[model samples]
Target: MSTRPILALISGANRGIGLAIATGLARQGAHVLVGCRDLSKGETACKALRAEGLQVRPVELDTTSTASVTRLAERIQQSYGYLDSLVNNAGIGVDDDPTLTTADRLQRTMSVNVLGPILLTDAMVPLLEASGRGRIVNVSSELASFGLRADPDWAFADFAMPIYQASKAALNSLTLSYARQLRDKGIKVNSICPGYTATEATNYAGNRTPDQAAVVAIRYALLNGDGPTGTFANDHGELPW
Candidate 1:
């Protein structure tokens, strides 16, 4: 009804899956806000997107920083007054090695992966509520699937990154909680795994490309009034919680 185009904010969108999602949404006529902690990188991404005649702008955001998160909320509220979509694409995963116990490593990992998205989503709820219909897509991992991990024969059952896995599980739970909280308000929130994409996080070991992985997130983000919420799914279908 607003005719302002679908306004979307994607964090950590400078590169990888985040950038791909931004591009996909923009190509579909959404005015995207590329949220990046590194302003230069954000600008670089936006420049490329702009060249493609896509509607997108770079916004300074660092999910781990309370000030940055709060500032982004304020900026969006003041600028657009409503946010139609939000993609919590900014996340970090560290090696599960003997160096994990350091105070710095533990706190930083959790702060980026878990606490950051939680705070960012909480801060942006008002903007999301302003939209008649809002969609929230949390970029979670299939690795967080407890149902799959419990099975000895699951493909990734042998893989282990305890802290990262736990953080994503927590993320999936929060996505459901937020979905329920905002259900009546018409804000759909869902957890989506981009599959094992070849990004910097995986050191390019993954078989899937960022563009290939962006499909499901784009689908979830652009769902209409009757789409499902509180779901954990991927390109395939609903994943076991």
Candidate 2:
């Protein structure tokens, strides 16, 4: 086993679930890179965590921009040379406006939630490969489960946010693809739903807190090479695809 301390990069870690994930990893002795679009907020989050004596660094990364994403990878490469984990937690939701065109909604939602992560992962895969024990955690949602949504008898079946749901569903697919492609490289990739966590994304109207949801993502991030890959799970356990 590599004696090197775990190094992780978490996107959109200024607040909410991303911040929670960063804190959890830092608390467990990992060097966490907190990625945020706004440098000030990222530094603030890093400062708060550092006050707790955790190893945390603020990284300004706008996942939606290739330039920003590339810069972050280069920074990480120069600073650490390798990364043990990546938590792609940055995402956004759009109003389910009937007046909005599908193209508009998809472009906005998929850009941040889907394309951004894919691009970042492509750029960072090399650094992750450098780590003997690499992991990737994509913070997904139960709402992304098509099986549950398609089930008429399921509770919360009435809950429907097309654009948001579609984005997560696609993320889940991407998770599987990366997991399979990188399995030989010893990189484990998995998707996790933080549950109905109360965050800005949900307007703080969720049952679970950000800390609660952070547990599941952190668990997968710290997994060993023998751990499950290409899977979707949460606090409760494995979720249906």
Across residues 69-107, which tens digit of lDDT does each residue of candidate 1 receive?
A: 999899898888999999999998874546666565667
C-alpha lDDT (0 to 100) for residue 73 of candidate 2: 89
The estimated TM-scores of all candidates read: 0.96, 0.96
- Model 1 Cα shift for residue 140 (angstroms): 0.6
Residue 125, model 1, lDDT: 87
Model 1 C-alpha RMSD vs. true structure (Å) is 1.3
Candidate 1: global Cα-lDDT? 0.91
The Cα error of candidate 1 at residue 116, in Å, is 0.9
Q: Which residue pairs in model 1 clash with each other? A: none
